[model samples]
Target: MRYSSITDRLADLGSEKWALHIRARQMQASGTDVIQLTIGEPDMPTDPLLIAEAQRAMNAGRYRYSNGRGEPSVVNALTARYTRRRADVTAENVLCFPGTQTALFAVMLGLVEAGDGVLVGDPLYATYDGVIQSTGAHRVTVPLKPEHGFHMQAADLEKAITPKCRVLLLNTPHNPTGAVLTADEIKAIGDICRKHDLWIVCDEVYEELIFNGPFASPFDDPELAERTVVVSSISKSHAAPGFRSGWAVGPVEFASRLLPVSETMLFGVQPFIADMTAYALTHDIGTSAAMRTSYKTRADLIVEGLSNVPGIVPLPPEAGMFTLIDVAGTGLTGEAFAWMLLEQEHVAVMPGSSFGVEAASFVRVSLTVPDTVIQEACARITKLAIRLLTPKERRA
Candidate 1:
């Protein structure tokens, strides 16, 4: 039997991260008590109000098919939800999906083709390459510098765009590095993409989790908003990932642009999920706000621990649940460093290479675990750092 190429592309999705880490998971499953921090999932409880809303929807028999777009009120709630950050948005501009990851994949299928060029940031979200590759597009990575706090540089992004570049994938409060793009940085990207006539796929799933300041969107401007496709969800925000709810918003021409392929992705998202999602979007969504506070505290604790460890060069993670600190100074390769920590310390963290090509010297540690777990993990990591460091290396 012959298998299609699309199936091959889809199969490689996130395999890199999991391929090497499966042994650790197996060890964990065998009663090793591994504190897994490899993924971005929050460890908090789902918003009770949102859960109750889902129950109400299920009770009301919202179990059938949706209008093939999404429930109207859900769409409207998403429209109004973004009002504070970007005032120009309305219900007409929104699209709903089971999650942001799928919505993002739709953008690729809709606007990109086998030979098209799609620019992604370096040290990117690992899934970006897999998803874009699934679209049969060329993935052009624009590397971000460490000294600059992984902030997207204007010139690098501008230089990366070519005539065939039709998509610009942007993520603020980025993963692995936890770097957020400033307004100027976002504007620089938006301006260039618009000038080049490219579709900007902005993943704002972490928009509501900013620790230091307000989140900015490319949709802040009318021109960019017109060309921009916004993907967001409750996974990171409301801690309701099990609900499997998220949405997309853009020009309907762009939003509905991939409905054909999306229908193939999964027959429209569940209606009860959509209804509860609508309630959460319209409701207070206070859980997201409260989680942000806890996240900020954890970030501080992690940074503090890493800072005191000899030969560990750490930076503050102002957003997201993780930090990318250079572990090269300890004389261990990224792969060896991560294995040593997991095997010796029994604390599971991601190797920097899981994120991007130039990440071999760094390791990403997630802060989603409880305070005690984080503190204990920090102790083991610090011991590993000290053990790995030579007297000569520690001097640096």
Candidate 2:
């Protein structure tokens, strides 16, 4: 019997972040005190209303095949949610999926061909590269500079686009940097895409997670609305990662194109999850609000506490639960700094390289832990940064 070597796409991809997360979890399981800030999972519980609704559905024998597109109520509630945000959405534009990750993959597979180029931001969501590679498309990363506050200019995006540029991937408030793109900025990209006949897939999974300022989106432009597919989920908003509920919204034609790919991949997303998600979307406003407020408070605490630490610049994030610290001058690589923090102070942070190529000198710290845990982690990191930055002779 002969086994096959993995394809180059799978063979070449590396996931240091997942490995670190797994190791951290294992260490914690062994009773070691590890402050995990690597993954983006919410620490809060699922919305109680959703739980109750799911129980009701189960009791009513609602276990059956889902409409491949999604539960009608789920789609309607999603339309209501997005319309409230931007006023341009309708239920027909929505496509439901088991998870935002799955929705995103479906969008990519539907839009791109083998060897077609896709533009993703650096530092970006790490899983994006894998998705692009497996789709047989080339990943062209547009660097988001620290000096520019991780904001990409329109001209920069133009230069990154080639004839093969089939898709432009965007996220806001961005994961590591938390830079939210303004409406004007979005239009600029929209204009470019419209000119070049390129499609877009905006991953707004963190849209509701904004910390400061109003959210701006490419979908806000009606001109680009048809070509743009927005992928979002209930996981972050409701603290229900296990629920596996998400949706994709675009013009009916574009939505229709993506649905077949999704159906082939998943047959359909779980209906009970969709039913629960609809209940949560309609009735769990309080849960989302409370979690948002909680994260905002945590963000403030970490930013204020870490401000006093020298040689580390905490770029204030406008949204999302992450902060990217400039660790270039620490005379240590981001990975080294992260491992040192883990070993010496027992705090685990994801290295910025996990996101994109240009974030090598930065490290992302998430605010998912409790406030006490956050304070403890901050103090520990403060001490570590001080030691690393302070002169050896100054240490008494």
Candidate 3:
């Protein structure tokens, strides 16, 4: 038996990235005192209002097959949300999907193909390379340097562009690094995209998790609106990951063009979920602000706890629920450090190499855990780092 080329293309995408996380879960299941901080799932529970909305819709018989576009409730809610940022947005500009991952998949499939390129920042979201590969497009990475606070540089984007590049995939409040682009930075990057005629596909699932300042996107710029597609969901914002409700907002023409691709992949999300999403979007549900504070506090805990520890440097995030700590000073690659930390200290974190080469000497710690877990994890991490340091290195 044989599989399609898509399997071959994604053979080494990111399966190994979860090995430590899986091991951590196995240990935890056996009652090991493991502090697992590898994933970014929100610790907050989904709001009852949203759940009731789904129940109401289901009882009202919304379980029937829906049109490919989306139920009116979600479509309208998305339109109103994006329209406030850009006046030209309309219902036709939005297409609902199961989640940000699926939206990115369909959007990439619609935008690029074999022999094309997707220029994405290194240390990107784990699934991005696979999404690009599924469309037969190769990923061209632009480094998001730690010196730049992990933000993507406009000049770097300009330098990385090639004729084969058709899309610039970005994850703001980025995964692993949690670097958020400022408004001016977005303008500069948008200028480069405008000049090069590249499609901007932004993954903004963490849009509401910003701690430093306002969130900015290429889709917020009127001039680049035609070329920008913003994909987001309630997973992070409303603490509704289980609902799997997300959407893509782009030009009307792009939505019109991508609908069939989306329909082919998934005709429409569950109507009850769409209704729940609508309520989540329109209401002033308090999850985003709450998570923002909680995650920021956890990040600060990591920084404060590890600042004086030998052979480790915690990079506090500007936004999002994870922080990257450079472990190069420990004289170990992130993978080795991560494995040792889990084995010796009973803690688990994602190695930076899992994200990209740029973060090879770093490890990503999730802020999704409670403060106590974060504090304990930091102590364990510090213990491991200090143990790894040679007496000579410690003196220096």
Candidate 4:
């Protein structure tokens, strides 16, 4: 039986990282009560305006084959949106895709190849390894420390860069840890990339989910414009995940070069979806604002609920929909704690190790759940921590 090498590269990189989540779903399928906080599917529904736009387009029979570049209206909307951030952004710089994941895949394919190294922050998003590997490029991790609030430091990026490195895969308002890069941080990292001649591929899927300060990215800097490519989607910002609408905004040349790569993967996103996306981008549908408040509140709840718990310390996130809780004081690795929590407490959360080495002793709880569920999950998590760290003699 012949199989592509990509299958091997992705063999251990796939569902294994999601084992805890999968197990949680299985338990719930069996009628078990589980407060699952593993994945970051937005709790909010898609805005009615966006849905109506999709419906209108579909009724008008906008369901036709679209060019690899994207539908013109959607492209224009993206251009206008990004141009506001960086005045030079135009239709030529936009390439629409199904989601951030797909846009990243195309960007990787266009930027690196076999024997190349991708400099990424440790404790990166789970699928990043697979994405890099699928392109036959190896991932080189730069440790992101807790003292830095998990933001990738320029010094770390400089130390991790090698002659073989071709790209810096970055995520801000980052997944798992939710650390948003400051403007200065972005410039510093961009400077390193400039010195090393590496392309900056940033995933900004959570751009609008910020709670601390304004969002920042290399793409926003005119100096880094040529080398920076930002991929984002409405999945999080607009609570429109099911629509599968996303895109890559980079230099016009990068978009031109990546066109074939994108076409090879997907001819183009559904045109009707593009119309919905355009509307989502241009209109203030209130989804991101609502989500920002909700997720921020939930993050606060997780920290407030577990901060003084016996053996767990919840790290507050600056942005994004997940909070990391360090379980090292409980004498358990994140993997062990997550499984035990699911089994003993009927609460499911992702083990931090699922992301990367730096997060090994932490568990990531999604803030996408209802407030009551978060409170209950925190209570149960506290109970488990107390039981684990308490003296056996005290537990009659």
Q: Each candidate: how many clashes?
A: 0, 0, 0, 0
Per-residue lDDT tens digits of candidate 4, residues 159-209?
998889999999997998999999999999999999999999989999988
lDDT leaderboard ranking: 4, 3, 2, 1
> How do all models score by TM-score?
0.94, 0.94, 0.98, 0.98
Residue pairs with colliding backbones in model 2 are none
lDDT of 2 by residue, 1-396 (tens): 654432666664665556666777888999989999887788888767778888888787777888888888798888898797667677778899988888888888888868799988889987888778778898887888877788877788888988888989888778888888988788887898898888888998888787667888887777887788889898887888888888889888888777888888877677677788888778735666676777788878887888767766677777777878877767787888888888888888888777866888888888788999989988888888878855663463
Can you tell me which runs of candidate 4 are displaced by over 4 Å?
392-396
Worst 10 residues of 1 by lDDT: 12-21
Q: Candidate 2, which segments miss by more than 4 Å at Cα?
A: 1-7, 12-15, 83-90, 389-396
Model 2, residue 112: displacement in angstroms?
A: 0.5
**For model 1, how does the per-residue alpha-carbon lDDT over 243-303 read when each residue is reduced to its tens digit?**
7788778876776556666677776778888878788777776876777788788878887
Report the lDDT tens digits of candidate 3 across residue range 115-226.
9999999998888889999989999999999999989999999999999999999889799898999999999999999999999999998888999778888898989988
lDDT of 1 at 333: 69
TM-score of 1: 0.94
Residue 299, model 1, lDDT: 75
Off by over 4 Å in 1: 83-88, 391-396
Once superposed on the true structure, which residue ranges of model 3 sit more than 4 Å away at CA? 393-396
Error of 2 at 266 (Å): 1.4
